[model samples]
Target: MASPLKVVILGGGTSGWMCAAALSAILKPGTPSSILDLRLIESADIGTVGVGEATLPHIKEFNDFLGINEAEFMRKTKATFKLGIEFRDWGQVGNSYIHPFGTFGQTLAGVEFQHYWTRAQALGEAASIEDYSYAIQAARGQKFDFPSEDKESIKSTFSYAYHFDAGLYAAFLRDFAEARGLKRTEGKVETVALKPDSGDIASLTLASGEVIEGDLFIDCSGFRGLLIEDHLHAGWEDWSRWLPCDRALAVPSERTDDFPSYTRSTALSAGWQWRIPLQHRTGNGYVYSSAFISDDDAQKALLANLDGAALMDPKPLRFKAGRRKKSWYKNCLTIGLSSGFLEPLESTSIYLVQIAVQTLIALFPSSKPGEPIDDKLADEFNRLIDIEYERVRDFLILHYHANTRTDSALWDYVRHMNVPDSLTHKIEQFKRRGYVKKYRDGLFSPPSWLAVFIGQGVVPHGYDRMADTMDDATVIEKLADMRVRIRANVDAMPDHADFVRDYCFVPPAKVMAEVSK
Candidate 1:
């Protein structure tokens, strides 16, 4: 048999551990498996940004693929179920709406439900599109139920993710990986030694003067890209001009009343504020533009609206929104924030990392590229990631550009700014006919587009002409019945707080002066 490949991953935050955990679970530990040897290096001194306590709906598949138990993972990570996201004051100030996980109403009488809803809406005989979405109804009441395996059930219309402590999540995955024979090195990387002839990394020198060698390298070094960028010199494409908000001040607080089943993004003057509720605590942060808001003011704004008492003062982080020119180069593959950061606006951060890993596994080479890393493979990978970035970028920009918040300079600038042709086309297509374009392979689906576009007041000019084939009165009656059915499904779900208590709960911390023992 051919020699097993040695894969050394740099850094040990969420990305490193996730990669380790995944590879370990897939390959036999200490068995000289075919083309697999996983190792991760990290330092306790270097702090990790755990602000991404929220996640998208795809996380379930990732966990499931690894055979991880959802309840155990949630309990260990202090996680709460996430139905979707709620946009507050995004379309217009004082206006709010939810972008739920699942689809809206089912097709009605040979026409999409939205079309009939729109036709009735055009005649003042229908309610907003939210009425037809079971997921949206459930989210509104702060409720949750496990999505059904049976596709025919209305519960199948509901999908959910998780809201957890990012730090604890890293810890959880670290255990999973270690138990599977992935070596965990606790040290800072001092230098990346390269092969003078091939221009590929040969070994990494730890701060302790120990050098660990590998056949291939995985760069999980956060935004610094210690191996991919610092060593290999992969260039970056800065998108701050298009997405100006560059700083984030995050803080965790005691769990407040009424744990929300969805993350809340409330628009602000210079940028926006996020409120993420976990089973243990609430995560608060302000993603703001340095040009418009000072760090001092940003921190103040982050503290002002927190529902619970502050546990720790805000810790700030700065990042540019963009991707590396090449994610795979020579013998190094960069994943997570090291490869790119598209902002966490849509909770795509963790999902991005997951995709990168899955892609690496699919494209895993048998030998360290006997000649050179396949340019075609690298090119295709970059292309796909670029689409991932741009598509999500546009969605985030939409929240800014399509808003009516005129209270600040930042809003004024973004309100009239030009967007990419692709996003522009999408918005135009939706506005003209309520038609949403799904990517050949990308994250958001049609219903996601409808949720945000319709929730934010981008109603269609007209519905499918075929929708008129149905009697107007019948269409109205059917829509009414659908709303009733959706409401009944949502009303049967358990309360969000009760679900956490019974399923998985993490108790808050307490400080005392004496030891019971």
Candidate 2:
């Protein structure tokens, strides 16, 4: 048989190590029939952009695939459970709502629950839509429990994610990868050499005069795109017109004893502030457009709004909202910041990396030894990546475009700015009659769209004809019943903080003592 494929990954933060750990586990490095020789290059001198503390539910699947014990991982990373995101003052000055990780309510008689709710709402017999979601109720009550396996139970309706320290999680994955026969080199790359004929990456020269060659190269380099853009010149497609927040200031504050189980995104004067509650500290940041807000003011705002005493000074970050023209180019693939950066409004940063790794494994190139890698494989991979990025872009745009905040120029501009036709169509469909378009792949099932649409005061003018088949009184009774059931189930769950302490508590004192060692 031919020799195993040599795969080299550059950079070593959350993205790089996640790729390393997942690839090494699935590709099987040291066995007689090993399919891959995995290696990673990262520098101790370089610092990573590690402020992404909150995540979506998909991360659970990634950890399970790596055979990581949840309790151990949580303790190591100081993670806390996340039910969903709570939006504040998006629609208007005093408004608040939650975009949950589960359904709003069960469908009734071949019609979506939204239509029935809409019909009941018009008759003045319905309550707020938030009442029907188990996840929203649990998050609001500061309660959490693992979803039940029984489908009939209201407790089984919701799913969960986590808020953890990005730096520590990367270290955790580094240990896992290294223990599984994955080689790691400590140095900075000086130059990337390309094959004269095929223009594919031939090898990398480290600053220390060491040369490393591989059949495939993965770029996890944070915004610089060292290999994908700096070397290969993969073009960037900027989406700043719609997503104008180009700068951020992140800092950690003292941990709070009464932290909630969900992330909080409050609309600020110029942009927005994010509060992510991890076990050790609360992650706080302000994402704003440079045109609307100065860096100094942004920093001050973030520091002033923190819930507890500041732990450290803010770390400034700069990024454009967009994706690479070709995520997979020649013999190199780009993941994480190198591929694209959609701001963490919905905490999708890690989920994007997870999806890229899974998609690459599914479409890994196949060729005989000494044969050229197929361009068709690259084409398919890029096509899939485009679908994922575009879908996520539209979802994020919905949050800004649907808002009615007139307190700031930033809000005014985004509220009236033209959006992508795809997003416009979805909004129009929902407005016409509470109908949400479904996708075969990518983020945002119907429930997510419903949450945002209804939350932002984009109420529909009509109901689906199918919803009319049910009696109005009957629909109202069903909606009330769902609210009661959701409340009953949510009240039974333990307090989020108490549950976390029992499940995976790692005292800050213990962590500091270990560091002191």
Candidate 3:
């Protein structure tokens, strides 16, 4: 019988537990029983940022991959279903739009649907392009339902994610991982020891003076990257220029009687604020630049927006929005905030963690170190992750850069700032022809771009020429049919708050009252 290799994971936040969950699910009953001696170490003394309360739909795949029941998962996490995000006052004050997860309509005549809609709008025969989106209708109507039938029907055309309590989610994953044979150790790592010859992490000594050894180390340590950056000397990539918000104040409030199934990102003077509704409570936060906005003002802004009674005091958090130069270096690999961080504008933190763990599993090395694991393999893994990060980064920047709100210095700067060439080209293409071209296996597809671009007031100059093949009246009628179908379906959905209470409500599974010392 073969022995299981020792797997050591540092830190116990969402990233750590996600890694544990994935590894446990795959390696628990490998070919032979007990083939993975997985151990996770984290300190109760350390605090997690705990602000990524919203998620992308990709999380469904992760949970499914782990055999998690959706209702049960949501119940445990106090999660609320999310169809998309509502960007309020982004293009200008009092103007809003939704960035949904589904398509605009079927691509038209070998040309995109958005083009035909754009042409109709130019011809004064159409409403906003958003009118054709089923998700937009459902979100606006505050409805929730799973597509039990034809997904192509406007009766079931939208995709969804979740707004959950982060701490509860970590605890849920921890339970899942532990149940699958992963060993967890509670301690503070005092020092990270490197191999004398290679300078690669060989072991970590705990505050109790006990040493834990492993051939490979997974760093889930938050911002500090204790092992990956602090000890390993991995460099940091500063993306503060492109993403300026650095400080945030997060607080939870009593659950509102009416819970919408969508997250809200309201444009603020220096940054933006997020409103995430969970079954148990409402999560609100003001993410902003300290240089431009005072901490007191940030706190005040967060407090002022509460729709319910305060559950707790505002928690302050600091961050730099960027990734490490090399997420994988030597024998240690960094995931989560250790790897990099983009603002949670689109609720991508969990997805990033999911991607990293999946990538690590796919690129899991041979038991013997320095025998087969090489830079080429690492490079390939990092390149995919790098591109994914860059893509998400560009998407986030578009939310800020494409806005027409230039009333404040913050907005003015972001409005006139020079964005990445990649983003610029995407905008140019979309505006020129109402066309969106996605990257090779990209995270955001054409519809995702269309939602944001059109929402942010990027009106196209012309529709696709081929779209002209469709008569204007015919196009308008088809679009109207889409709207009618969507409205009927949305009106039939169960109330979001009611659906959650019946299906996925958890009554305070667990709460961390304080940071352990």
Candidate 4:
């Protein structure tokens, strides 16, 4: 039998542990036919960038794949249900809309609901496009409920994610991964040695003078890229001109009484502020461009706009807005912040990590002795990771480029700045008609684009000709009916806070005790 593949993951926190847990669980590390020998190296001195608190609904699938109890995970992570994200003042000041986890009204006669809504909107007969969405209604009402399994039911139209403590989540996964035969070393990597023949990563030397050798290395080292960039010299691609938000000040605030079921991204001068409400506290941050705003001003802005009393001093983070030239270079695969950063505008940081881990597992390489790791596998992996990053990049850029906020130089510059041809084509297509580009796989689905386009005032000049199949009066009636049904359904659901209390409420005393440990 071929020997098991030796895999060493650099760094810990969310990405490393997630990879560890998933790899250990799926590959069955110590079994008779064990395919993987996995270990992770992290240090007490090196801190993780644990600011990612909001997540996409895909997280549930990851957790479910690990067979984790949802309620228990939530309790341990201090999580709360997230229906969608509510954006304020991105299109223009005081304008608000939700990028829901689900679709708007159903397709009509092979034409999208957006086309029909556009036609109705032209006639001034339809309400805001937000009216037809079950998720938006539920979010607006501060309600929570599990999506129904019945596809025909309106309640089934929406999905949910979570707002949790990132630090706690990593710790939770650490326990999980360790239980499944993942060996974790509490030391920092001091140097990386490369093979003279293949030039791939040969071994990692720790500060404690211990050397660990592995066939494959996964870099989750955040921003620095550690093995992927520093050691392997996988180039960087700078999207700073288009994205430009290079600095952030994140701080936790006291928990508020109002427990909404969605994250809120409120646009501010020079940049934006994100409010993510967890079970224990509200996660708040001001993501701003250092070139456009001073760090001192950004810190003051974050403190002034918080929903509750500040729990801790604002923690500053600096990053560029782009990705590595190659996510998978040679034998090292970069995941999480190491691969790239598109900011957390749409809560896609965790999703990106999840996708990389999933993709790596899907295209897992051979472990046979004397056989080279197929370059084709690495090529395909890089291709997929590139697509995911580009898609997310375009989506995040849309939030800034489509805005009309003239109050700050940051907003003004992004409003008129040149974007990628791919994004420009999408914008033009949507504006000409209510058309959204479809992807066979990856993110920023039609519904997500529709929400951002319409929400940000990118009104269509025409609708799909097929939308005219339905008479004007009938379209208006159907629109009104959808609104009524969504409103009624959301109203019937339990309050978000109440639902959380019943489902996964973590006591403050318990949280403190756990933290002390």
Candidate 5:
């Protein structure tokens, strides 16, 4: 029998623990046929960048794959449901719209609903596109409920994500992974040793002089990229000229009575601010460019704009906007911030980590004696990782480039600066006919693109010719009907706070205890 492939994950935050849990669950040891020996090394002195409070609906799939109980996870983590993200001023000041998690209106005559809505607008109908989305309506009404299984029903049109404490989540997964037989090392890594012949990592030496050997290394060491960059010299691909926000001021504030069902990103003078409400408290942050705004001013801005009393002094985090040149090189794969960082404008940090872990598992290699590392697998893995980063980069750029805010140099610069040809092409295509660029795999879907395009005032000059085939009266009537049905469905759903209280409410004493600790 071939020997087991020893997988050593370096760093312990959400990424490392997630990888550990999944690997331990899928490849349990104790049998000769079992193929993986998993261990995660995390240091007590190192702090994780845990400001990722919001998430996309895909997190549910990740949790389900690991066999975690949804309610229990939510209760333990102090999580709140997220229907979608509400943008306050990206298009222009005082203009608000939500990028929902589900589709807008059902297709008409095999054509997308946005095209029909565009045609209706040209015919003197003036309802906002937001009127036809079930998710937007639910979000606006502060309602929450699981989607129905009936595909034809409006109640089934929307999906949900979560707002939780990232630190608690990592701890929860630590317990989970350890229970499944994954070993944990508590010391900090001091140095890495490489093979002279292949330059692949051979072992990691800890500060205590204990050397741990492994066949494969996974780097989740945040921006430093200890193994991937410091050791292997994987170059960085900087996108700062496009996404110049280099600093963030994150702080938690007291929770309020109004627990909305969505995250909120409001445009600021030099950058933007985020409002993420968890069950225990509200997570707030100002992601801004230091070149344009001083750190002192940014801190003051964040403190002034909070929803409630500040729970703690604002904490600062710094980062550039880009991914590593190669996510997978030789035997080491970079996940999370080590691989890349696109701002959490759309809550994609966790999703990126999830995708990398899933991709790695799919292309897992054997490390039998004298077996060479497969170049083909590494190449394919890098290709897939590139697609994920570039696609997400373009989507985040759209949020800034498509904006109509011109109050500050920051907004004006992003609005007029030249974007990637891929993004420019997508903008032009949407401008002409409201057509969204499709992809085989990536984050944002058509509904997501349409929401930003229309919400940010990127009105198209024309609609799909097929949309013209529908009579003007029928199109208007159908849209009006959709609006009515969406409103009714949202009205029937329970209040967001009430639903949370019933489903996964954390006890006040437990929450306070965690806070005190």
Candidate 6:
């Protein structure tokens, strides 16, 4: 039998355990056997920025890949269902829209329902596009239900993610990985050493002077990129000009009885505030550009707007909105914050970690022990990482640029800023008609783009020429009918809180206290 490959992962946050769990699943497929010897080094002194509470629907697939039981995982993490994100006051004061994890109404005559909706709007016969989405209606109604498997069912249109305690989630996955033979070493990494010839990471020396070596190094260290950047000299790509919100003040507050099914991002003066409700408490944060708003003022704004009494003092996190020039450098692969950062506007922080780990697994090295590392495989990994980061970067930029808010300098600057030509072409194409550029693979589908564009008041001049075939009366009638069906389906679903209780409730002390009232 071949000797096991030694895999060393630095840092132990959500990213570390996610990598450990997923890698364990991959190596021990079908039965419990190890192809890789995995060990994670995490420090008690180092802290993780635990504000990533909300997630996209892709997280469900990651959990399923690890063979996790959804109900058990939710209970352990204090999670709540997230059907979509609701943007409040982004277009104008009091304006609101939901970017759902689902499609708009089903195709009308083989054309996307949005084109028909656009035609009806031009004829002054349509309602807000929000009325035609099942996820949006259910979210607005504070309802919850697992998506139906039946393709023809309206309830099957949407997918769901989760809002959970990031810290608890890490611990949950720690138990999972540890049970599957993942070793955990607790100590601070004093220094990282590199090979003289290859320049790849050779070993990490602990504060206690213990040297640990590995064939492969996974950097999960936050922001610092301890191995991938600090040791290998992989460059950081600054994206502050495009995504300028460089600081965040995160805090937790008491959970309220009304647990909405969607995360909310309310536009503030200089930036935006996010409200993510889990079962135990609500996670709140104000992400702002320090160039525009003072840190003290940002903290004040965040505290003032929370849904309930603050549970802890607000903790500040500073980060640039960009990624590493090369996420995979030589034999070291950077995962999580060590790799790079794009702000958590769309809850892509955890999703990005999942993608990196999954990508590495797909492009796992084929070289035998004691052979040279494959440069071609590492380059391919970096390429995939670049595509994911850039695609997400553009989507986030659209949120900042497609705004109508003129109340602050931040808004004015972003609204008029010179966006990338890629984004420029997309917006122009959408404005000419109701169209969205389709991707073979990436985040943010057509419905996602449509939600943002139409929600921010970007009205197209024309519909798809194909949509013109439908008469105005017919289009209006069908849209209205779709709205009726969406509302009825949403109305039939259970309350979000009640569903959590009946399905996978974990009665934490705080949650129980809130429920008693």
**Model 4 residue 459 distance off true place after TM-score fit, in angstroms:** 0.4
Q: For each candidate, what is the lDDT?
A: 0.84, 0.91, 0.84, 0.92, 0.91, 0.89
Off by over 4 Å in 1: 368-371, 508-517
Clashing pairs in 4: none
Model 6 spans with C-alpha error above 4 angstroms: 29-33, 510-517
Model 5 lDDT vs. the true structure?
Answer: 0.91
Candidate 2 stretches greater than 4 Å from native? 515-517
Q: Against the true structure, what is every candidate's RMSD?
A: 2.4, 1.0, 2.5, 1.0, 1.1, 2.4
lDDT tens per residue, model 4, 1-517: 7788889999999999999999988998877798788999999799998999999999999999999999999999999999999999999999999999998998878889999898888898889889899999899999999999999998899899999999999999999999988899999888889989898988999999999999889999999999998889999999999998999999999998888999999999888899999888899999999988899999999999998999889999999998999999988999999999999999999999999999999999875733568999999999998999999999999999998877888888998999999999999999898789789877878999999999999999988898898898998888888889888888899999999999999889998888678
Error of 3 at 103 (Å): 1.6
Error of 4 at 110 (Å): 1.6
Q: Please state the error at residue 232 of candidate 4 in Å.
A: 0.8
Model 4 quality (TM-score) = 0.99
Over 165-250, each residue of candidate 5 has an lDDT whose tens digit, in order, gives 99989999999988888889999999999999999999999999999998889999999999999999989999999999999999
The 10-residue segment with the lowest total lDDT in model 2: 364-373
TM per candidate comes to 0.96, 0.99, 0.95, 0.99, 0.98, 0.97
* Candidate 5 wrong stretches, greater than 4 Å: 30-32, 515-517
Better of 4 and 6 by TM-score: 4
What C-alpha lDDT, on a 0 to 100 scale, does residue 206 get in candidate 2?
A: 100
The lDDT of model 4 is 0.92
Position 421, candidate 1: lDDT: 85
Model 1, 1-517: lDDT tens digits are: 6656778998888888888888888774457654677778898998888789899988889899989898889888878989888988888789888888988888766666777777888889998788888878888899988888999877788799999888888988998888878888899988888998999888999999999988779998899999888889999988776788999999987777868789999988888888998766788899999999999988898899888899888998999988898888888988899999877878999998998888887777655533456667777777787777778888877777787777889988887888878889999988887778768988888888888888777889977888889897888888888888888888888998999889976555421111111
> Residue-wise lDDT of candidate 6 within 429-494, one digit each (tens)?
899987898887677899999999999988888878998887778888888888898888898899
